[model samples]
Target: MKRVTGIGGIFFKSADPKALGAWYRDHLGLDVTDWGGAIFEWGGADSAKGMTIWSPFKQDTTYMAPSTSSFMLNFRVADLDGLLATLRAEGCNVVGEPQTSEQGKFGWVLDPEGNKVELWEPPAGE
Candidate 1:
């Protein structure tokens, strides 16, 4: 039951997500995409390790709800279902039901300090 393998993404609330992304793109040289996020490939774009995402959302967004934190951390996991079940059994505050998309399985849990933590299991062969 390996838990957090590595950081999957970093999401934060911003007054102006586009502007902030642009700033990072211009100043920090991040390859901010049209959707206002950047992906950093580890090893390479086709690496088995996958990439990490950096995105910002609107300040009023409820994506990080149930927690008053300004940012949420997304962690890469080998087994989302198993890890989530283990977390729940360990008395961790597992959030909503898991979801699936092209990006793979996703789940969340609140940290002791109440920060929203995202768990991501990349699609097979990703």
Candidate 2:
């Protein structure tokens, strides 16, 4: 049995939720709503389109680390360098250096709430 299809959605809790949402909207040039949340449209030129909804999940459970919160948000991107440059220009705290692996290319950035968002550049010929 082939399991379910690709990732349907990802939801995570956040601190300073409003600030986080606004940051994504401003720096990333995303269509985050005024009320703040992201609804993504997933489709390559040759692939069928699917909708992705994102929001800051409400956290009622205990923190995952000694002082850190639970969960992080990762976004797959095409132009990693461009995006990273833009993020840095906006004065975002870019954590760690960009890297490549068998899966493809990867980079990380931390949000205001200290959530690490991963950016990925898929391998060619996908």
Candidate 3:
């Protein structure tokens, strides 16, 4: 049998959740419901949402307060340039420039809480 499908939602405790949510909306332009926790609708199974929650614990670090996860969540995107441009225009701290590796074109964006959020544009045939 096949494994799970994809991530559904990521629920983390933010020090200032309101500000964090606003940051996600202002920078990434995600559809933040509750006025702040932005949700990006990923295309997958209708049942996929029920089957998976992408808030998998970071393997590299042991559990502590939810805030210290030690790694950022990554979202695969279609248009990296446009998104990055918009982020820059919004005065966001887009770090280290965009890097292309075997994985794909990747970059990092810092949230209001200073957590690094990674964005990737997958290569062809992915």
Candidate 4:
């Protein structure tokens, strides 16, 4: 019943995503990828290995839609379905149906402040 294991990613809106990513890459020494993001890997082979993503989106992007917040927090979850169910039963503001992709499974919810929160369940061995 582990609701959240860790932070999966941090996404925010930027006036110019490409330039912003470059700034971070140049000034902060972040290895921003071509896709305009960076992946920070952690944990040991003997332990549970995981990654946290850092990315920026265009100001008009609708990815973080339904939320006017400048930033969005993505949390890693061990069991997306189970936790989503629990959240719904607890009167939480769970958003649309879950989605799956090569990255993993994703779900959404809105906090009391109306900020959109993303829940992710990574594929096995990731």
The C-alpha local distance difference test score for the whole of candidate 2 amounts to 0.70
TM-score, structure 1 vs. true: 0.64
Clashing pairs in 2: none
Worst 10 residues of 3 by lDDT: 46-55
Ten residues in sequence with the least summed lDDT for candidate 4:
21-30
lDDT of 4 by residue, 1-126 (tens): 888766666666567788767645543346899899998767886869666777789999887868888787776777899878877886777888999999999999876556677889999777
lDDT of each: 0.77, 0.70, 0.69, 0.77
Leading candidate by TM-score? 2
For each candidate, give its TM-score against the true structure.
0.64, 0.69, 0.67, 0.65
Query: For model 3, how does the per-residue alpha-carbon lDDT over 16-106 read when each residue is reduced to its tens digit?
Result: 8877777776677677788566566544765232122356565666422233556577777678888888888988877767889896798
lDDT at 21, model 3? 72
Model 4 RMSD vs true structure: 12.9
Q: How well does candidate 2 score on lDDT at residue 87? A: 92
Give candidate 2's error at residue 54 in angstroms: 14
Residue ranges of candidate 4 with Cα displaced over 4 Å:
1-42
TM-score between candidate 2 and the true structure = 0.69
Error of 1 at 7 (Å): 9.6
Better of 3 and 4 by lDDT: 4
Off by over 4 Å in 2: 1-8, 44-67
